[model samples]
Target chain A: MFDQSNHLPALPGVGYKPQHYSDLLADPAPVGWLEIHAENYMGAGGRPIAQLKYLAERFPISVHGVGLSIGGECDLDPDHLARLEHLCDWLNPASFSEHLAWSTHESAFLNDLLPLPYTEATLNRVCAHIDQLQDVIGRRMLLENPSSYLAFDESTYEEPAFLAEVSKRTGCGLLLDVNNIFVSATNLNYDPRAYVDAFPLDKVGEIHLGGHDEDEDDHGAPLLIDSHGREVADPVWTLLDYTLARSGPLPTLIEWDTDVPEWPLLAAEARRAQTALAQLDSKVTA
Target chain B: MSQSAFNAALLNPTANRPNGLSDAGGRPAGKRFDVYRNNVTVSLREALETGFPATARLLGEQNFNTIATGYLRANPPSSPLMMLYGGGFPRYISAIPALAKLAYLRDVARLEYAMRQSYHAEDAPALDPARLASLPPEALNNARLTFAAATQLVLTPWPIHAIRAKALGESGENPPAHAQPTLVTRPEFDPILTPLPADQGDLCGALMAGKTLAEASTLHPAADLGQLLGTLLASQALTDIHVEERT
Candidate 1:
């Protein structure tokens, strides 16, 4: 099932920030790649574009989108799809992706990636949305797994099976965010490892490892919130190790959105992921 | 469902309470809708906090959160995602009847919002300083210079620049002596809010208004004309230059 056989690179990469542009450019560290939110650079001209240009010249770029509302019942957002096309034209990122959730209904942008039931109606809508995105952008996208809080009674399909179906239908790749698996598994009361094992590994083009927060559900049961804020937790690291062992080293990203740590701290986290991959490599070769 | 009715249902789910479109499954639909609404409101509020941490700090987190929620409900996002959430926030605050007593609030909001705008503003190369140096004094005066896309000269009746600086941690700096002109430029990736002297401010306004250098200088003779032009050029604030032949 694996066509791409080369081992992925093992250099550290942090979320590219405009505030640290000068610092990043000044010190030419051996950073591998930089990831940016596609929605932030949707506008025609701006500092976001400027800084991204400067960094893209030297580093591999990834355009991670937080919009597009792929799972929504409504048609694809033409305006967003156009902006995404423009971004792809301007910045030829190594990869482009969005979450497997809905964010908008009608015209009002809800601003959160809300979950959708895995039914035939949703599957058709999501496939149509993905087709529209590909038709506009002229490139395949990686759909990331979402961290969902609530489960719908109408969802007949299991999470992994639904994700596999989306990939099979749309020809889009998967962005496996292990932290989301842990969070959603805990919230929905499922086995995280089962999810990691069931994932269509051949379809996974990238990996996301982030930190989650501990919270209490309505029943006062412990839940994990995929906050993307603090350092990656030990359980998440273990899941990542499991994924690497299965996927055999992918382009893993460390995402820290809220309360972004200092550059060095983020750099260190990226290094930790690199170390995990290296450890896996040694075991596989031995 | 009809387009308008579907839109109404999505935007205001309560509109369909009579037909049971509100609740999904057995649970109250309002609870689910409330969760979605709360997420939208909180996300936009977080964008505001991220964009204008100083404003959030100055207004206090609770107050900012309260204002942000109201703004979200009043003007739900038109875009599928954020990145332009608070475009109307400044104007909203200016007319929010309750905030009328705080006159400077609008200016602060405007200043911070503009900074965010400029921060995300497009990247452009600054004008070459040597080009300015090569132009003859007469040609330099008559040359029509265009500022960079990220430079915005905002003239307000409030000491907005000083207020922003203080909010951003320049606590000991002296406040502006009076209402002044503020220049928001992104020399680098982040927007830098700098207070412009009266003469230089006039020159910037003239340049922004598509006036020739000579015309701008005529409006403010005391302006250091050389350094003022250089300040913009060095920072890439000036992008293109054209000198018209005398008619």
Candidate 2:
């Protein structure tokens, strides 16, 4: 495994937005770091890559990939893997991460993260893909747990157990999205705390916190959509506090991709996560 | 079900649920699967809308949604990059029989595609205007200018730039009756589209085909070469100028 000694700082960050590029360059503020979708910067060259070059000089950037489809049934796309390798080679980000969900199958790229059955077959497939990814990027990648509206009957293993097994086999780190735990637990009608307790916190290298919209499943159960369109909800914040209390501190990100708010608002959200991290530090030093 | 089969089911709403697919509670996952399906279609549709905003506006919300759905079902994204999505959209728009009345729609979509392409094109420093002016009079004939990667000349049979401006609320006047050839260039960050006269368009087309200034001028002898050069310089479209090597 590639050495991760210089991973992201255990502070609060936000997904980088183009509109806030000038503001960030002018005043980076107290923000700990910035994250970006890898695919967005995959173009040949332009303002997006140029802005990233500028920010990479100032902040520890995390390249969060949304398209790897690590959990796909088919072998990983060599072309996509090459592009990712090229990007990682150029950016040399502090951290690289992709979701545990699949977005591509049969060469058709589905835009959203889709869930998979957590079976032994899948565990093996995902581990192979993660191995390939780590080998190509020449660095360790954090596999983020996905928030889902449904679960499959073929899933022989629980989500947390499956993730633990994958980490054990691949030596990959985890990106524990507290909001995803809350959203998935709520949608699947389980206790969020239990899910968090069952997670392998020591294997976690980063954390994600995003806003979700509330709706109802067909059975009238509360369904939380992982829609990063607004501020982090109070429960998700509380969940973050819960997970941090166990994991100490991790590089947490405030992801607001859709209906993106002003830079100040997003910075404020990052500040809120920082407040929680500060509380953890206070408790630890106490 | 197999992973590919499951994905196929998710993409095609009309397809039957994959065998043995059930929710966490061991119940039928029909309603639950619908959520994933909705997420996929809705997100792709939103991406198409973002890529072709003017086309969406011209067709209106409901009509555009219908068209986007049909297009998506027919031509799902082959790449994960949203920027690379909707490449087949212009042709798809042109092939629609219902949109036959809007003859300029496809060209407008093509213009939008060009703007997107230019926005993401490779960055290069604009050549100084003096480089061209200081060229020895004899060398001027063989001087072949290299345009920036973001420079694109879009020739259309309709007033697409005007129509786009009106749709985007950038202009108050209605689109004119004449066909308009437009030049797209990204001097800084944002891509700008400028209307070009037919003669200038012909000259630009010729120049883009690797024709030297003298040879390109032959295509439009009456065109104001100075004005055309001025426009290109003003837009920072010319990246490098060099004398063509004698074979």
Candidate 3:
């Protein structure tokens, strides 16, 4: 087996933003760690890289990559892997993760995290990709479950089962995104709680929660778009509570990527996540 | 269906859904598949609309969206780095029949892209202007200077700096119907632009191309090389200075 774990404290973290850099430095509480998209810092040199260097010294950084196309059928992009290696070499972040989704086809990279079918073929493909990523990064990398808008007929395993098999095969940790779980459950007609019950909680190294938008399919069924443009929905928070109670506590994160609000508001969300972990802590102690 | 087919459909909204896709009911994923399609276009369009703000402003938001959709479908990103997604957009739109009349618009887009490149360029310290002053005249004449990675020279036949300034809501003198030369430099982190007097660009361009000071000075006699060198040094654009044997 491999080291499929991370060192992030089991506390709430917020995604880093340039606007909030000063605030984070001024009041460094509640936010126990920070996560950044690996591609944004792939540039040779800039303020983005310089700031990450500074922040890494102060807080634990989890390099969450969004563009690796880990589930694509093609071989992993060697140049992209080298860039990821270069970033990890210098930053040496506390944790790193990527979504179990494909974003590229041939030469064109679709900028969205497109869903993948969990068949034996894809299972093998994803495991190989993670093995390559972990080997290059020289550490265990967590794989996040993507929020899907539709299911595939070819899929041989349910989402949780597929995630488990990948973790088992690749020795990669799971970044259980409760919001994605909730969204996928509602869209795919499954009980979110049942889905969580089936999840392998022991392998979870971190958790993610983000805002989503509600829409409808052509059939008028509820469809949720994982638009991290606003506050997390109430039901997702409840689902997070359910998850934390079972998994104990983990390095939970609040991801607000679009139309970001003020620092205080985002920090408040982190405080709420902290309360969730704290509640679980009290139960264990009592 | 193949990932290529799915991606093709994602980029083209009118394309039919790939096989094997379905909603929870196991039926045809008509609108469900549309979600992925919508995400692909909307995200790429937003990246362009935000990236070339001046170009977006020249063409109003509504028009920009329409052009962005066209450009994205035609020149979908080859790489996953969205920061580098629009590298070819300036040329892509310059050939558009609708935008053919805005000849300077192409240069404006080029300037915007240069600014972005300079923003992410490697950081290097600037050589002090006094270093050039301390060099003896012969040594100075033979000196070949290196520029900061953030330095860029955009030479155009239109008042690009003025056009960009006005488009960005900055009050500036009405752009003349003549050529303009611009210098781009990032002293700290943010990239800024300086308008150079016409023809002085040749001197700076030559020096930037690694020409010796005497050789660059010979390229443009009317232009004040001393003043231009002082400005480049003041902008902290020069990184290294090597005085080679006089040639």
Candidate 4:
């Protein structure tokens, strides 16, 4: 009874942190929907679940999983998959997505979105995991691009190519994290626009913009950490315009996870995103 | 490199950033690797602090950081549900020698953990007190109380309730040295810690162990069954009551 299209409105949304619960409801203004970290709401009940239920009625929630470890060598945890099924069965969110990075090694959950080495073997494992996830959740899922600080010697495929092939194989969609594009591009010495140009824009279901921390890697090159703690960076915003120009407008989320600011600040960010989406809507119609 | 090797090095900041990792250039990636190390430890440390705020306050911020760092390394979360992380932390603090000076610290951690657990515990509709009131005294004596999923009883020798209250700046009195059993009850969304006297704690414990009201009341002569029941009712701790019929 729960199978339905996994689509979020092509507009601005924000990652729902508990701190913003009251303000998000009070005056969300231009936020088209909300996205929740699946791990945070996995609890059986309480304020988290209560708030989700109430908000789900009013907004299209996108369940974003941060700990699925889709790229892990170990087989996907059946219990974790079951939790996802339960959440989907209940929330039946407008969209569901997890990262291309793995966060677990065996039973230990590292709780960080660790990078993956792009290879045929890794592709096979990720596709298998996505297949299992879709099968169990009974919904198409979106695989998100990771923000990388370093490259793996073992990787054979470019990041965009690997993502496209995974989507093609698993029939899953892609979530283009725009900030990650800029972060990875800067850290790895590539053009963010070119990465967007090579991306399979047709497959992108969601777009994400979040804050990154600036640091220097071993050789004094810029290293951008996907901190998600501050306002969306300016260059990352430019990349979003580039992506939206190509993707033509998608459900763009302003993700502020750590040190989440007051709601008005986040709402302002959402308003900016809304303007971008509104402009695209007019262009597509024009 | 193997994920196991990566995992081993990720948790141990002291471990050599190790060879075989790299930046975009072929240069060895020691600093690039520390980004992951910093992310893992720092993020998990913050999570631990959130899960045990009272404990964090009881042990000063620096001491809590030291213990949390040690506890996190010894017991990284087994599941992705960070809300459920630090289940073993109370026991972890008990074994630390440096914290041994703080006799109440372990139980305080346990109390804080229980509060967090109860905060996220399943919501259940409280049993209407009128039902119990309507029952005849004899039948009520035979009745078995079913506690709400969000209710927890943590028995500790330290006055954890007073300590938490003082930590929260709700009171100024240094908690008198006495055994306190904290009853964690979520009347709404926030879990409330109520210190129960020994007799009342035993009475609640008995009810939790499937003892009937009469049987539970018998365990503690000093327990004010009426007042205790009133407190539970006010907290919405009881979800249902099944009074046995003579058969």
List DockQ, one per candidate, in order. Answer: 0.34, 0.69, 0.85, 0.80
Q: What fraction of the true Cα-Cα contacts (under 8 Å, chains A to B) does candidate 2 also have?
A: 0.77
TM-score each candidate.
0.82, 0.95, 0.97, 0.97
Model 1 iRMSD vs. native? 4.7
**RMSD to the hidden true structure, all candidates:** 4.8, 2.4, 2.4, 1.8
Candidate 3 residues lying further than 4 Å off, grouped into runs, are: A1-6
Compose the digit string of candidate 1's lDDT tens values, residues A1-286: 1111222244446667766677667773545777899887776576566567767777778788887888877777777788899888767677788988877777777778777777788788888888889888888889999986556656778878988999999999998998899888876778889998898998998888889888654446665667788999999899988888888878888898888877777777888888987898799899
| Worst window of 10 by summed lDDT in candidate 1 chain B | B17-26
* lDDT (CA) per prediction: 0.75, 0.88, 0.89, 0.89
Instruction: Chain B TM-score per candidate, please.
Output: 0.84, 0.95, 0.95, 0.95
- Candidate 1 residues lying further than 4 Å off, grouped into runs, are A1-14, A18-32, A43-47, B1-38, B80-83, B125-143, B171-177, B188-207, B211-236, B243-247
Clashing pairs in model 3?
Answer: none
The full ranking of all candidates by DockQ, starting with the best, is 3, 4, 2, 1
Between prediction 1 and prediction 2, which has the larger TM-score? 2
**Candidate 3 docking quality: incorrect, acceptable, medium or high:** high
lDDT of 1: 0.75
Identify the superior model by lDDT, candidate 2 or candidate 4.
4
Candidate 2 runs further than 4 Å off: A1-5, A25-30
Pairs with steric clashes in candidate 1: A45-B122, A46-B121, A46-B122, A47-B120, A47-B121, B126-B236, B141-B214, B148-B237
Model 3 residue B130 CA deviation (Å) reads 2.3
Error of 3 at A282 (Å): 1.3
Better of 1 and 4 by DockQ: 4
